[model samples]
Target: MLAHLRSNPSLLKLDLYCKGIQLDDSCLVTDDGGRPILRTRAGLGSGLEAILPGGLWTNVPVTEPFAQHSPYTLHRFTSGTYWIHWQGEPVTEVALSPRPAWYDATLPNGKEMTHIGTLQGTYLGIYQAKVCEYWTAKPEKTNCKFCSVGLNLGVDDADEKSVEEVMTVVRRAREESGITYVDFNTGHYDGDTYLDILEPYILRIKEELGLLVGVQTPPHRDLKRYDGLREMGVNRVSFCFEIFDPKLFREICPGKHEEYGLDYYLEAIRYCAGLASKGPRHEPWVTNGEIIAGLEPPESSIAAIDWITSVGAVPTVCVFRPLVHTDLEDWAPPKTEEMVPVFRRLYEACMERGLPIGCAPNVHVSLVMLPEECAGLSKKRYPWQRLKLEAKKRMFKYAFERRLQTLERRVA
Candidate 1:
């Protein structure tokens, strides 16, 4: 089932809603930020955001318990052994993500530490503010038609997070879970000063903890703000330009489509990639261009990947989940087969340009396909990258020997 999940993430819906055992809430699932949820697992390739458990799975969001059937269920075969059952047939051995020790700790404000910075896969995800400024706009107008960030995180109308509170959780998460990357993300804010609000927090985290940082926010008019991000040792930055098709982009992300436009996104990604350099500390990924894979016509998604990669940026193709309680809640999820080919192109395009495939095993968010995971592109592995690394090692050895000889001759 785990292997199946890597290639076919749609199966995760089954893993999420599967009902085989009723474990204690604290053990596997617990309330973080007022919603019963599971923080991502490092063990699971990338962690996923999912709804509450113990219900029959439905193709669409339905309140009524009409279909009393689930394709998957959890079964503990014996002590220390577990297996997932598909339609009452045992399919494969599986284990639920272990409850992180830090999840039980408390913050300076006495709130559970988990609420401050929850682990998404191995990366810590902190949504600095609870409500998006766009939500403050007319009810119908928002950047993305399919986003439910504030609602699903159960952070609606909450107070903005203080730097101390967030830093405290970062420290605990590092000490307890060995977290390697910290990703700070925000929905639209009124003043467009999301970077400004994040700067101090980012500076402190890098100076204090020395952790790799990643930020995902709306495009800022002033690209110079990214210079501060580069100096702060940010590993990778991403822009959520949800779709590529200009017309449908306007239909889905009204605020972004009208205000920033697709060209702004392209320019922002290019500017950051050009100057935003994280010298030696962070991993080498420069930028990420995120698109909801099935949001537009599949052809546009392919074109988007091509355009993003051509500009020295990697692409993240997030499979569209039919979010509950959103305007598109009744809409169906994209077919898994359709996404397979689209993801293949995503991988191929990135590999074509030799873009870094993100900070590996760690910081893998289950929400999208990581470039290295694209098996279709793996066949044409670049031997040159390895040869380059080996050459650098050999040159370093010769240079060190020559220096040693010079020092000995001078001393003699």
Candidate 2:
């Protein structure tokens, strides 16, 4: 098992999520040109971003209490090199996720570029709206127990972002970072206004930049709003129903349980998954039913993955990180052994269903292991299916890049 982990970068990433790394005295993150640790929206990632062997980008936890006891430690040498040492033995050399120049640049309105959005792996991630209504509800708050969205707003992310400001940052990310995808995430609102708040930004990104755009927000009260999103060129829609066990779901995500029941989330996922064949054929569409693994039993998480894939929607399984100051702050993260089966199912379920996993270009996520990235965890192999996916990847990349170039020339 140890040998396999050392050999496979994706497994290393999964283990790092469960057992975070400790920083050595020789380590100097930003001083050595590393990206600063900022608690962005949702606050799931608050760590140093580094690329492991085999080009796997990851956010390694350093500030959390569990990380302080980890056997893994990151070391920076006097010659300006970084290596990960496990039990005082070197495991693999790592590279810092590059700090884009625009991270230091400011907008015309004097807002910092990073305040609008930040890179998650190679793609741009913007927390599109204000704090979730659950966090701001009067008398008492009912936000997700494991989330830090309320705690992060107005700190790392700006309280509000204009569509024009977002477009400027999106253009810069594409031009400089070579990002082909942009993801916008939002929390609950009073009037199901999250979709209304996001459509303008999505339209501009599609019309002007011609990049792949995704929306991760609460399921709207009106399911038909998704049809309009598809026609508007939204390539992906993700609903984060963070726990699968019905009873636990209510306890963990009180606001979600109260506002839109778990059944509604599943229904929306099914509804949106069916929209794949109805939209513009040039635009690839995917529906993700996201869940946090550590918040529930391994069997429950696997069940969620199975149900999601059964419906032609992919499962995005996230390792529950007990971020500081959140309601679940004292909870322990799931063990890697317990999570291996969950992630293995994640890959197998998607492959068995012939879902389009890992087709996006330059989209390597740092917060969670993508389904395709979990291929290493499973012993099962699907050679024919793998071949079909490769062909699709090449075709999609070519078409998408050609569209971007044509748009750029037209604007020029």
Candidate 3:
């Protein structure tokens, strides 16, 4: 399937996510002057690099030097030229994300605004609540073994950003950097009352910035409580089901599974989707469900996908990367070959259901990655056709320019 897709030029812009990087134990490299140039790795010798459209390749370094520590890094390289080096060797041309303007500013309370949150790509991520309730459980807890949620809870005093502080950063990011998306994710909190404390912060950011915002939370006690979120001008909501398998879900996310059973999680997601579907414009609020691949069987993963789509929500698939300092650090990630099939199957299923697979805001993969397949299955024809026509126009312009340049040389 990969070979077939590679031959079809129309199927460009492929985005792949997997556990760690390398396919086997071999180091990844791109051919430069007949020499194999080593790229980044996930760990000492782990990582995978794939050739993307236009002969561009993306190398993701996934390295785990310690039992509970794994960090992923991204690098993009062309056949003959280097664009950017994230953490390795320097490149001639680099695309660096600029610090948001508000990062350096101080708030009314004399707190440095930039210390509250940081810019990721074009999105602003604020970690207002630094502690999660799940980690406080007694021995043998199920708080998603792959997460480092509690890693910085105590030491990272600077990690917690206030609502006002985040708002100041948002204004600065928007005015100086033109950022339009903001996401808020929290560590598990011990108390159920954390939501009440967090709500006002979300409301204030939305009221002040009017930017498209996404908030991640466990299923609230009352599903209707989310209506307040929508009213607060939030554009999307993501409730994470890190692993789809019921057994693994319980084992991995014990706190969440025990607190809100699988049935309740699905119910809340469906409720949110229905609410988003009824709004004035019918622009479905970005409802998202996530599945961590490799943690469960393909069938279980597929079932989760089916469940999310059935609820009129989009499933955001995350490749299980073993993070250091997590309980599952010793576990190995699924091979890329194994992951491709799951991705293709889920992509096909979402297409058949007429569900907007990539409609979830701030998500990395969307219809853009599988344009041909998505276009073939879509009810609307304009989007894909427009893209096809644009491609043709660019090709024609290049040919015409080449011919004109040849004629000019002859005249000279």
Candidate 4:
């Protein structure tokens, strides 16, 4: 049931992304207790991710999936009553990722804390210095045709956020929403400008809040810079080599291909894991290779899963979302049925390797099911493995509940 919810986000949501928490209309979908849920479009375009109860992560459609019809809709009972129904039956109780208590927090600079970083899934996302050189560069030669990262410039958040503004939100989110990580995304600005600009923010986040940091950027010309990032306590690194097929990768991500090539991304992550393994600090997974599952043939995704896991990196597979107003707006995404087998293969590959699967629930985003959750479908698990998995699941639940409990000041 959880997997279905994660797979079929368009089945329930009326909108593709969350309308900002500042708007009461964002409450079109909310919990039974009458708290606003997050499933409306955000930013300049309609791409967004949402986390469901029990840590299930899903990519929501920006528009209606079925052209003004779907089996699922929110059924309101009494004034404070709500339930998610599919095909006229209440399948299960559902809730949205709530507005974090610090959404309205004000920074010392007078800018609202949320205006600096938007809450995405469980982590806060800061698209600091939103300019991407590729978008401005020769259009035909650069710019990933599928990406809208640069399209968001000046639409909502600032082009550049100061360290202090980001710090205010991080601290408040930790206290209020219990966010454990900050995922910083950037486009190459002035030849390695992305990391150079992001480094200070990373350093402050580590020294001030002791938060885990994840970076998504094109690989630096010098792969050794990854060691520098690890030394500064970056928890994870991801490269969006969106497709496994080389020709398609080069075509879709012309900037990444022409600038650094796929080898740069693969080697950088392999090196990150190796450096962390030999270093004093170690976490479950140090590197992630992000692949859009439906962008290429399912076979390409499965092959990518095999290769990425083989090289000490986990594959963060996203279902392809054809956003409105992007170059690929008219493109259609694969059906949910097509993705089940692809994700199932992904789950098996990770389990076969015994890679540490899920991040701590507090920090893990639900854009897709973590390897640990997908491992549930494995019928051939060893008895001991099942016991260990159960124990870990309990641990995550208990840890997450502890954070939620803090919200109930009445209990304490």
Candidate 5:
């Protein structure tokens, strides 16, 4: 297990998620140019943001209860280097994900730029609009048991953000951070207005910045809205179902189950995936069905992956993090051995279906293990599919950069 963890950075990432790292007293993350660990983005992320070996950006758990018992500890030296030691033996040297200047900047309205949006890995993540309605449901709240969205809004994110405020932050992230993608995510809103609230921001980003843009919200009752999003140049759409097991899904995500059943989420994924071929040829589009792995059995997670890929949509598997203040705070995270098969299927299934897995430019996500990043965990190699993906990745990067350059020249 030690040798496997040492050799495969991807496996190391999964283990860190399972068994979080303990910070040595010598480590000064912020002073050393590391991003401050803030609990943002639906509460699944509340840990130290650092780059592991092999250029994998991860949000390592540090503040959680389980991390206190972890064998992995992070230490920094006087020479300004950081290393992770497992059982008092050195495992790997790591770099902090740099804190951007915009993190400290404020908008003209006196709102901090970070309150509007923050970088999740290499891209900008904006949790647009107010708290999820489920948290404020009448009589009793029905928010997801594992989600901390309600707790995070006023603490780390603003309750309300104007489109202009978002644009300002987006501009700063693009110019300063060189982010090629801007992702807007929202929790469920009354009357299914999440998409209505997001369209203006999406249009502005597409028209002005020409950066890759993605939207994650509850499945809008009207599926045709996605067709309109495709027409308007939205690059990606994601639906977070949380758990794949039908009974568990109802118990875990009561709001989602009560309003739109599990079947509806699957239908939305299938519908939006079909629109991938209908959108503008120049704009790349993908549909994602997101699930948290630790909540259900690993076999259930693998089944979810197969089902997602079967419909031409990709599966986004997040390690179920028992964030502080959430209902599931005391639950244990899934073991690394249990998760290996789930993530392994994540890679092989994508390859077998010939889905476009890793063609995006400079998209290194810290929240979840991307499908293409799981290649190291699997021994089976689809050499032909791997070759095709490499070709696609190169071509896509060239075209994306060229488009950005043209946009810059036009603005100049």
Candidate 6:
């Protein structure tokens, strides 16, 4: 697939979500022997020496890796040509994201600046506050099995950054990095108290930073809280129902489903969208229904996407990649081929309905970047077929396992 994409040169934006560090590993600079000499969590060029026109490495001061905890930078290569090494296999000749100036900067507080609050490109990824009350409740506990929130928490002394600090970082990021849009996500908080804690920070960023900001939260205790969100300068809102299947929701995200219940989540999404008043500018309060592809059935997954759209929210489907040191580390990610169609179908549906893709910036490829040959009919069909089959296969396997469990219990 990488070779095919490379030969085409027209495939512009690729949403390589859930591929993990291997997707991130795309940023490493390799020696002549193909061994990585340096690894960066930022954009590709950060760790690469100034390679001459002939591709010869030179002695240069390579900036430290950009660390916003996103995989968008991997999409920007010179002229959008790069390679992705997945599970040790090289998916070569892919396009990389444009390196932002703020990829390597230091803040007023002596903190390394790499757009700590938001990332650049077609996808806008944000961590509203580094700290979550869930982590506070169990200091030893990690974030949800799918998150890397603890990566920053484990290293930094401060868990949550002040609104002043966030505003400063965002201002610097926009002025320096050319970041246009921002998405904000938080860890779980205790009760309904966290909304107040987040309001000031959200408002300051919207007013002070002045970028299109998206906020992700559980259903707000008071729907009225959304009024504050809009006044604070928020353009979109995402209430992530991570897994739409009821049983999977309980098993995978017990804390969220148990705390809020599925009906409340649906109601919140509807209410938030209504409050935001969706349209081209404020057309729909961008609502995101997050589906972890490999964990549930394809029909169920597709049904969830339909549900989100039915409620006038966009379905933001993500491949399920387990994070290291999390509860589900032993789990494996869904096949990349399997994810393509789900993405394409959901994207097409949203496009048809005029719903904006709000979860990750990359998902809304047309917003920030465009792939070269996306207009070609064949290019469009390939992703659709591949993703649909993979989604179906995984869903079947899950059902099979459940049936086997039922039989075993009867035998016992």
What tens-digit string does per-residue lDDT give for candidate 6 at 1-412?
Answer: 5454334322222233333222244344341212122221111111222221212122111222211233323322444345544333544443223444554556777665443543423334545554665444443453344544545453522455667666666766556555556666666677676567667766665444445667767787788887767655566677767677888787766667657877788888777667645333321245565556667766677677777777777665544545445566566545545555555556555545545333222123311112111222133344554455456445544543454456457656
lDDT ranking of the models: 5, 2, 4, 1, 3, 6
Q: How would the candidate models be sorted by TM-score, starting from the highest?
A: 5, 2, 4, 1, 3, 6
Report the lDDT of model 3 for residue 74. 34
lDDT of 3: 0.54
| Model 2 per-residue lDDT tens digits across residues 1-412 | 5576679887899999998999999988887778888885766788889998877888988788989998899999888999998888888889999888999999998999999999998999999878999998878798999889888887788888998999999989988999999999999999999999999999989999999999999999899999999999899999999998999999999999999999999999999999999979899999999999999999999999999999999998889888999988898989999999999999999999999999998899888899988888888889999999999999999999899889989999
Give one digit per residue, the lDDT tens place, for model 4 in 311-344: 8788887766655556765666666556666677
Tell me the lDDT of model 2 at 211: 95
Q: Which 10 residues in a row give candidate 3 its minimum summed lDDT?
A: 34-43
Task: After superposing candidate 6 on the true structure, give the runs of residues whose Cα lies further than 4 Å from its correct spot.
Answer: 1-92, 98-101, 114-126, 136-143, 156-158, 278-284, 357-412
Candidate 5 stretches with Cα past 4 Å from truth are none
When 4 and 5 are scored with lDDT, the better candidate is 5
160-220: candidate 5 lDDT, tens digit per residue: 8998999999999999999999999999998999999999999999888899999999999
Which has the better lDDT: candidate 2, or candidate 5? 5
Q: What is the TM-score of each candidate against the true structure?
A: 0.77, 0.98, 0.68, 0.81, 0.99, 0.66
In angstroms, give how far residue 158 of model 1 lies from its true place: 4.9
lDDT (0 to 1) per candidate: 0.61, 0.91, 0.54, 0.63, 0.93, 0.49
lDDT for 397 (candidate 5): 93
Clashes of 2: 0
Please give the lDDT score at residue 320 for candidate 3. Answer: 65
Per-residue lDDT over 1-412 for candidate 1, one digit per residue giving the tens place of the 0 to 100 score: 4456434333444333222122222333232221134322111111223222221111221121211233544445426454545566655544344457777777656777766777654567787765566666775557366776645455321256788888888988777777767898877777787888888888887666656688988888888878767776676789988799988888878888766888899899988777634444323447888888767878889899898888888887766654545666566556555666677777677656766563333454534556655643335666775455346445544543454456457656
Task: Give the winner by TM-score: 2 or 6.
Answer: 2
